[model samples]
Target chain A: MTETSHAIRIEDRDDPRIAAYRDVRERDLIGRQGCFIAEGEVVLRVLLGGARFDLDSILIAANRLDGLQPLLASVPRHVPVYAAASPVMDAVVGFHIHRGILAVGRIGAPLMADDLLTSLPPRALVLALVGIANHDNMGGIFRNAAAFGVNAVFLDDTSCDPLYRKAVRVSVGGCLKIPFARIGSAEVLVDALAAHGVAAYALSPSGTTDLSDLVPAAQSALLLGAEGPGLPHEVLQRAHTVRISMADGFDSLNVATSSGIALHALRAKSFPLT
Target chain B: MTETSHAIRIEDRDDPRIAAYRDVRERDLIGRQGCFIAEGEVVLRVLLGGARFDLDSILIAANRLDGLQPLLASVPRHVPVYAAASPVMDAVVGFHIHRGILAVGRIGAPLMADDLLTSLPPRALVLALVGIANHDNMGGIFRNAAAFGVNAVFLDDTSCDPLYRKAVRVSVGGCLKIPFARIGSAEVLVDALAAHGVAAYALSPSGTTDLSDLVPAAQSALLLGAEGPGLPHEVLQRAHTVRISMADGFDSLNVATSSGIALHALRAKSFPLT
Candidate 1:
């Protein structure tokens, strides 16, 4: 088969051009400079479709190339697409490239929290997360945000990076599409949301208001925390506390599931799904 | 610290009493005769609270014994509690027993599908699952079912066993608390639900009615399928179809997240938070 115009075949695992794809598990993705790994075809497509992140190069198994032509055509020619046989691909990444597609993406300067808040339209739904350390939960939240039309997400410094590989895959590539920022602190986040006229609600089992009873404002933010050690008392006190009323003795819902339910309940009244 | 009456300290991994707790990962939990592994302190507490499943025995690390007194006291005197040093505990389970709590639970015969269905009160909500094979997803659905005050859960034989170890832990031990039955097939389950006058709603991306527009009857069932191959087309045809309206060009939400959202929506009109 004739290779696509953007294809660059690499026969050796030691090739210097493919350095970024090596020993991925050892790399500290959260603190790494500029580049992020987008695994699987769905996530790679999401990475390419958006303007916020740019393609650096892609390393894929030889057989996966033909099926991805339609998606690959959109990648600028300058963004090299490296094709390798399955064994070489596995050796480079230290694991089987089961999905047979991997991409090196260059992320631009993160959107500033204040700038992102100002950029929102008059009515917007924002998910403000505090201390959400689990990668899967982080990914699931981004997915829920995207599904229900949340304008953007603001993650506290304590939260894990959305671009982390597992989170990206678990989100089904949602982390690539949703707009997000690592804002400094939960206090600053709540204050900023209040200043922007967004009604911020902290979710907790002891929340004063029932989620069913509280009406959403024109602009709203749903505040969430990690599983066991929930939101700090100060953060909870800063925002209006709302609880997903449940059976009396059960622990609170998982953070991701809670977010989806809350987002669905508070979806814009005029959004028309109903 | 001195030991409690039920505590039996075991210094050797070869002890025959710890046989059920050994090399647990290698065992097939689904096809196993009558036993299920319940890990973590929370799940152990949940297991002890319920009467349907009886405790075979418990294995704990030496340090964890002091904190578990109240719960340990509740265990029947007939059931033995084995305390092992941390290393021996690790060797016995073939991994670090980090939470240091493991209980061998004996499941009674599965609740009959017709008996469970007929046992529901005048007004009830049920979550019926089809083809949910992932352990994490199975655990999650049980967690959500518990949170939203669902009366009972019915899983088709095609679904993974909810009592699998990972499912039990992921459910935060919800699998222990929630009354669940493994019924024969989607067809038989749907027919039984219809006979009981429960409105069964099969959830899918392509559906006739929006989830927001769904009106729950006196008794309701939300039918969910595995993520990629949603409910079998015939199953969707058999029950009224409903979808969570989402943004354009986006994939569907995670199966567990979808269940939480759909359950919350239907829960509002008919059920009250316990």
Candidate 2:
């Protein structure tokens, strides 16, 4: 159980050597200031293969270290590997650990809204979160964004941080693959969309215009909001409000689910190959 | 807090008076018998208004009892209400409190596979879960099923109980509204689907037939599996495998998200009325 190559072994929960791994819960409390953690081998591998994110280190359960040896072999030998017994790992994480492996990654700098606009193809679908505070929904949106051909994502200040551990885990590592930016305000986002010549459509269950009626624009940004409250009046006033027609008696679709359907409908009309 | 009309005060968690709310975690243990617990006022109201399910009782935190007074007024005096302090309520439920209300409902008697078939329309889109074990995905399927006009859902033996608390909560109480039945085995479900003149299509991320190309059958059953392992070989062998076309480099969508899109597309073509 002790045979290891490059991974560092630590039996202590308070090891200053693993300071980044300590106070894991506090990381999520700081909002945008904290790092994102990807758990399990599947998500870790996806994050590593994806473009331009800093991997802080990989932690492996002492007994299960061999299970991740092949993954370790692929990465640079200099990358630190923290190995600990299951009990020690549990104590450090402050929870019962199911996934035997964990990887901490630094959140990349936010992209300029204009950069996302120009970088995307002429015909592209983008997801814009106006004030979605639910971390799981934010994660689900990113996952759907990757599934459908969403070129980029823009999160207003009110949206939850997509790089939080729960978001990353819920996204199944899709947050790493999809290009996203955090714009300052809804007004700024609307203006940015205008500058890029991208039609910004707010998705509201009770919107006046039918989403199906709108001919897919060359490039479009779908503005989504939190459930119940929906998009702010100012935000809706600034952009076109479009509704996905649903059968009567149904209240509304979940925000993330609605985004998936909306993105698919948008992509169905004009998915950019380039 | 003591102004009670129908609400009965319960001072002890161990009191037989609250037997319906006892050992909820243990009751939720698979293969063990359990009653369904629905949280939040919104979901509780939805269930009461929409479904024919039996109500056992309602539990509310003492501080929030007044908020639920109107709802209690509508229910029969025979239906007991239990009130406790927030801390006591949390201690009994083994979790922190939110929504400040919980309703226990008796599980409806199991529906026969034939019953679902008889109820289905001529042009129907149904979701058949062959081996989906995740309760969240099961719940998501029901939510999407309701939204997209999936006529009914047939759960195979390998699938988790759709009425599990987590599933019900995640489904946003759609489990109560959506018509579903446990079909015992894949063979029985296949037979029932065939009897209803439904075409059984297994959804795979890498199947031969493109999903867009597959015309909606007079009646269609979209079969989905667990996220990673995918549809069981036997089920796929029995079904017509269809693949959802996606942009290259992205992995498969979460099973629930995939189901949502598949159901939406199929419903549009199959159930034109919806």
Candidate 3:
């Protein structure tokens, strides 16, 4: 049942209250007034269940409000919860949203990278992404970071924004839960990690150390670069470089997949028998 | 330089010789008379470099033919090589093919599950997927399977076709390289593994053993299920169930990311110090 305080019925596609959700599927509608769209029922649940960010509004198919009372009740009373017909939503979003749930929230601002590093626990696992332009890989890396108990993520200047709609969707709302800061170039990231007393392991095909052979330090950071042109030479030279061995003829694993394996490899070493 | 023998120019979007390439971007052009389209430069390179399947034809934007001489020269003389102007190629493919290289290849028949299992080496790593309907997950898993030196992969009947164009694209041609066969049900898959003296590890959140604690066997298989429902109860009962531990409140990892981590974890154990 739609809550009396929550239900703001939207009959037309162009309803101004739900305007942010319109044409969402045409391309990424990220960073519209420092806000990002959280799509699907699961991601919306993440938004409503947490207080990490201010929820601006939510829009859903009118028919789905029946069993979602508890979920909807969590939405702040001030947040306009818009309900529209599925067809109206489809028309507005420019794509059929099978999940029929959407929410908009401010991303706030990226925290100071140095402050984020300083705030970590003594024994922490951090993910540092360098030159990761693809939203899919960026999202997957964040999902891995959250899963493996990463203390923080520091993205280099060249990496794509994790708040991008596709990235947030791909991360399964991990981009919401995890604390991330975008910093300067790869060289600056390496220097910061060193300054923070964090042992850095830069992953690349040409790395000097095998992933299995490297033991995790009390404070560790796994550095992942974009797929083709991997970590900059200066960055790789500064960190304790490592590589995941593959089958004889195989060249490389997908960057996102590689990070998952690499993060787990380090995470297992640090948290064995936990 | 476009190889002299390979310079078969396609003038019109409706060319009969290139009919299968038409509207390829609209949806998957897989299983057209037992054929599949291998798109992009990297994947096409994978197909031409290997002979696992016969190439039916090759198509490219004429502009890209200059630097691809060696790649095109390797195409068998008997194979039809077609080239078109970028616009014409764009019109036929329905979506803009930014990579501008495509190939049609025969999938042949999927190998018999029993035969594929029988052919594995004595000490082998294999992957088994169940009810993985999503093409992206299917592709990512195959990429992991190939990277970890999994001797073979087996998919249950309920899973989607890996040769579907999107899956192939996602796998980065791991689907074309690694041998895979579709078996019956999850139960039947378990039975086959048992018969082959392969120790099966089924990943589930509710599994009895933590992933970090599991030791791989000489003949081991990692079984993965779809994201939400995970492995069926019957299948879990039949295998050594394992779970990748997460942070306190996190629920799950992406299926493909989970497989990469799981496969690598097991691979690290089976081939320790390799």
Global lDDT of each candidate: 0.86, 0.79, 0.84
lDDT of 3 by residue, A95-177 (tens): 88888888889978668998998998878888899999999998888777777767789999999988899898888887888
TM-score, candidate number 2: 0.90
Candidate 1 Cα deviation (angstroms), residue B10: 1.3
Give the runs in model 2 whose Cα sits over 4 Å from its true position.
A1-5, A9-15, A30-34, A62-70, A84-88, A272-274, B1-16, B30-34, B61-78, B81-96
- Stretches of model 3 off by over 4 angstroms after superposition: A1-5, A26-31, A271-274, B1-3, B26-30, B272-274
Number of the predicted model whose lDDT against the real structure is largest: 1
Query: 1 or 3, which is superior by lDDT?
Result: 1
Residue pairs clashing in model 3 are: B23-B92
TM for candidate 3 is 0.94
Indicate the worst ten consecutive residues by lDDT in candidate 1 chain A: A265-274
Per-residue lDDT tens digits for candidate 1, residues A141-176, read 988887887889998889998988888888878888
Model 1: residues with Cα > 4 Å off, grouped in runs: A28-32, A268-274, B28-32
> What is the Å distance of residue B212 in model 2 from its true position?
2.6
lDDT of 1 by residue, B1-274 (tens): 6677789999889999898888888875434468898988888878777647988999989998899888899898899999999999999889898899899989878888788899998889999999999999999999998888788999988999889888988998888888988887888888889898988999999988988888878888999999999998778888999988888777789999999888887776567655
Sorted on TM-score, best first, the list reads 1, 3, 2
Number of backbone clashes in candidate 1: 0
Please report how far candidate 1 places residue B5 from its true position, in Å.
Answer: 1.9
